[model samples]
Target: MRDLYSFIIWILSYQIITGQDPPREQYNISCHKVRETCMQDPSKSVPRCIENYMRRCSMIRTRTPVEGYYTRDMSDSRPMLETEEGIIVHISSEALQKSRTKEKMNSNLIVSLVNKTFFVTNSSPEVVYGDNVLGVWLGVKEISNLSEPVQLRFINSNQNENVSCVYWHLDQNGNGYWSTEGCSTNVTNNEFVCSCNHISFFAVLINPKIPEEIHIVRLNYISYVGSALSIVFTATVVIMFLCQRKKHSENSIIIHAQLAGSLFLLHVLFLCSVWFSDRSDQVCTTLGLLLHWCLLATFSWTAIEGFHLYLLLVRVFNIYFKRYMLKISLVAWGVPTVTVMICGIIGKYTSVYGKYAIHEEKEKSSNTSICWITTQTVISYITVNGYLGLVMLFNTVMLAVVLVKMHKLRSQDVQIKLNKKRLWKDWVSLLGLCCVLGVPWSLAFFTRVPLNLPVLYMFTVLNSFQGVFLFLWFLTLTCKARKEEFVPSKGTLNVSFQSTEEHITTNVVSNMIQKK
Candidate 1:
């Protein structure tokens, strides 16, 4: 009993040291075989196979036995048998060595063959003289897209003295599929004298590999170009706003220019910081969070603009200009600032921002790129886009109300009604400017799916054209400049158009000059 416990412990130790766990049944069967075979040759039994098994098991276990039971003389003397699915076979030293050698050479190969249902067998083990032979049974070669697996039966008829060993090989046609092929060898006892020789059968498999560089390159290129365009357009708008500030009246420049310029510039900086850098850095991660939050601020500002204009024209409510400006500015800037700060703090604590990048399975094109919030982060997304949508809706309604009220006022007044009508036209033009600049963009942004590089670039290009549209419209609206009032000082183009009296005065002057 003590010896049995020692043997089990040794086997376990060997398994641990070698990192090899052969089937537990293999050891159990060998032990059972030893017990049965011992009964047959009780007096001659130092059960050689059992001792050899213990030795192999012990090599992998915690402790090594100082002395072994099986003598070198008895190593080859024991006649052993193993059964594989009703096929009885002789187990010889050569067969054992063959199995060991194959395991040492390639571990995964045998496992792959096993997974493919390849069966290895011994070649005529019963007829040969203490011989070592490796053979296998294989399925027939399969051909065609819709056919069943081929079936083949293998038989081995060797002398009783020989050993049996088998392994399988797979033949691949370079495509993803494979066919089975059996490889085997036969060795004599004399071969065991110098070095124990063995044979094995195996199959080969090809793994699937994806080309990573192509995708990476495309994504990076899109990001770089999109980021560059966004930054450039934003910078240009900001610079134009700053440089042309003194040329415009103080009210027009400060109220419109500063807010618009700041929003545009901030959006540019946000885009560049979020998408331009490699996503592995902490800066990129934080920027991604921060940028989206600032984007919310921009949305809020758009609402502020719409609301302010609506209050001025629609007569739904009256607000002092100072109070309106302060309140709108505070709400627009403060909301995003606070939201972003909270997000940053949460991210610092949890190390996970509420955003991620998504890509398609076969996405190799830059045009297919988008970095957007997922449905899971829809709360934040809705807050930004929904606010813009509501503001736009309100602005549309307000514009309609203003048009109706101005028409009603014109119908009631007879004198200076033309002038009031002109003022109404100016308001309409202002509304047109807002619609052209803001409406299409808001529509695109609200309806678009997950944002990516191409979308970013497209949006930037569209928004960049906003300044041109505004400048052209403003210039066209102020087209009635008179020669007498042509006072161009510094960068300001201050000129007024002539009324009928001014025209008559100009003609009288011209007539006097002609007579002289």
Candidate 2:
């Protein structure tokens, strides 16, 4: 017992130091003799029995090939043997050495055979000795060798069933490193089967492709352009509200200003922090937290807008609340701050932001390194997207109620006369209001279909231009209302208020009630 323990410890130490797997136990059997028995009870004894038979089979090895040997035609003269198992072509020492060197550098090597390129990736080159000759296991994908009888070379060893193969090609920019754009791979015992539509050089890359890097360039372009435009228009809206503070003091105006402010900050901070996410971890984290707060605040403000609209139309006479803006500010800002703080605490204890890879069999995946919530973990999803989803659902319900109220009001005002131009203006104003007040965001639920790209694009476009829509609506409404006069009563002189559609509705309602 003592000797066995000592030998086991020494073997483990040797394996650790040498960075090699433990030697496999050799078994011998004849597959030809046990073929019928193995076939009959495949699930029970076939795999084990076949593995033993493979262990006993003699490994064939070939000598090193010269430099020009790859392009040579050995179809007629090369020795060929057929067996019930499979065709096995031994590799030469020179080829094995070259493959090993290339594998060490990139782990993705290219071999040109008969004017065709084959990619070598996923599996490493394994050295094997047979009949005093040296060889290596070389997994190659034939890109344009469909018509030719391709030879596969491998080193006889204990094959692992869990090994997977992936297809690889050279990077699009000629960066030397290969990419897995159009290639897919399958594994069978010790061999890799690669498939691709187009004829090109392919390889089995050991490193999986980073999913985030795939479309980052295009995404960055969209974000930069969208954020810049959003900032410009949002700033304009803020300035307009500030300049005309005394003119419009309604709850709706106040809520709109706050929502625009939050959106402005969100866009600005996103632009600044996203580009520098890789440089400083602390800065990225800080910006990420601020961005999260701004996002939540924006949603909160939108919800507030919905609430205000609901009160204005539904409970116009009954609406009464002390310090409305102050209370709303607390809910809008405090909730997000609390949420972000909790997320921050959780992140400190566990990883919530960083590079993550999602593997799904047939779906396009994302691998990203960013200072944002990762969807890879359940906690992150529940805290981030889940929370936002609830907010969106509430806002959507509010939007429906607001729309119904607006429609009813329009129907009640059917006696009012308007030209074609005025009618067009009203339609535009309504559309703009809907966009700025989070109606487009509600459409996000419709983006889960098979053709989601277009819906997502529309959402991004509409949401990014929210500031522009708000600015246009403000300018149009204010300019038109400035030309009209609001006479409150006979004794009171003409009082000019910066009029909005909501104020117009209130004035009409008060007049009707007084007349009654």
Candidate 3:
């Protein structure tokens, strides 16, 4: 028994000395795996995926052959290099010389071109630039501060906005985040060029996020109150217009009614958006579609307002389009309906509408949920802001035309001399007409940039009360139209808008013809 125990002890000692497990190979994560995980259903959290992959990659032992990159050693000269993924890397002769002096002559230059960025991610906290924007990790082992910037050429990530060069930096949370400390970006139609001083994982960020502020909460509050007031005011105006249809049946009045109706519908639906946002996918989707349609309808009608004004003010003669109201209604209502239908079809394939975060985004939790366009940046841009852009641009030109023509003709009517109070009233009426034509919409352009707090406040307040302003403008026009209906009966030329049911009777035009 003693001999057997001694033999067992010797065997155990020999096993401990000779058979300890070989140190496990450092983590070897495949870029393929990273992409696979990132593309998973419902998408992995960006920070978590980045943290996981980065943690794995940092542990990976650098070897002659690395995953997802072409490793080439620079010894004799500057090399023209391209990756299998069609990423182009350029090393200037001066940069090569700098590399020779800064890094070991045999150090390898690596180009890691992944289809998607493993570092920067689209988390719920912030809006990402674009989906096609890729992440490229450039590395020169133990190298920093070269004589010339190393150039990296990538396929253009986004076309609409400028792309910014950034590197992966660990934030306070110890997760990878994008920072613009050491790189410069040059953009073109076909590609993006990144020039950097030091080597790290690089990518492009477009359209820097609107910085979060406590004032955003205040803006939301203002929007809420203004929208509520607009709802009441616009609803009342729409109802009055419906009741007084025979009294104010002019084309401009009809157009104004449609505008008020659109605003009324918009604010009514908008007020319920938050409560209904969390209901269900189908409910949220339908609400989103309705909101989108209302907005487009508003924009379409605003464009029509500009067109009508141009006809009345600039081309006062030779004015007639067959079935004019029918055609205009088709464009104002039908086009946006068609657009929303197309988007609803597309929304099935992608997340185009759902719960929209309403609180300051950088916060972890938000109390309010708005049923708006949740994703689909391109579609949102085209249908919402881009459409508004075109409408506002057209209206701006119309406003300018009105200003010039009105100024030239301000005192042209010698027969109908106006007192100062009457002239100022005309100016006030014209200004109100311009506002009702969507001048406040331009405030959004200013708020599109980061940190425009004052402009943001202005944008929120003015746009939210757009309907109320339109209602007041209508009231003024109604009072003026009523008082001036009997002016044509008088022999004296009114030299102001003599509105009739079928047309805007600009007697000034006829008087000018008579003078000629």
Q: Which one wins on lDDT? A: 3
lDDT by residue (1-516, candidate 2, tens digit) is 999977876786454223232233222232233233334543332322322233232222226533211211122334222222232332233333333334342112112211111122112121111111111112222233233323333232344322222322333222122344454555566664444333332333332322334344554566678888989988998888776676757666677788889989988877766666666666766777777778888878877776776676667678889998899889988898998888788889764553222222222344223455543346545655576677677766755665565455455545332345645655675566576567777656555443444665677677777777777778876665565565344322233443243653564465456456
Residue 504 in model 1: shift from native, Å? 29
lDDT of 1 at 215: 47
For every model shown, the clashing-pair count is: 22, 4, 0
Q: Cα RMSDs of all predictions?
A: 23.1, 14.1, 11.1
User: Global lDDT for candidate 2?
Assistant: 0.51
The global C-alpha lDDT for each of the candidates, from Candidate 1 onward, is 0.39, 0.51, 0.64
Report the candidate with higher TM-score, 1 versus 2: 2
- What residue runs in model 2 are displaced by over 4 Å at the alpha carbon? 1-219, 354-370, 417-422, 443-448, 485-504, 507-516
Q: Rank the candidates by TM-score, best first.
A: 3, 2, 1
Q: In model 1, what lDDT does residue 16 have? A: 28
Off by over 4 Å in 3: 1-26, 30-48, 58-213, 360-364, 411-419, 486-507
User: What is the alpha-carbon RMSD of candidate 1 to the true structure?
Assistant: 23.1
* Model 3 quality (TM-score): 0.65
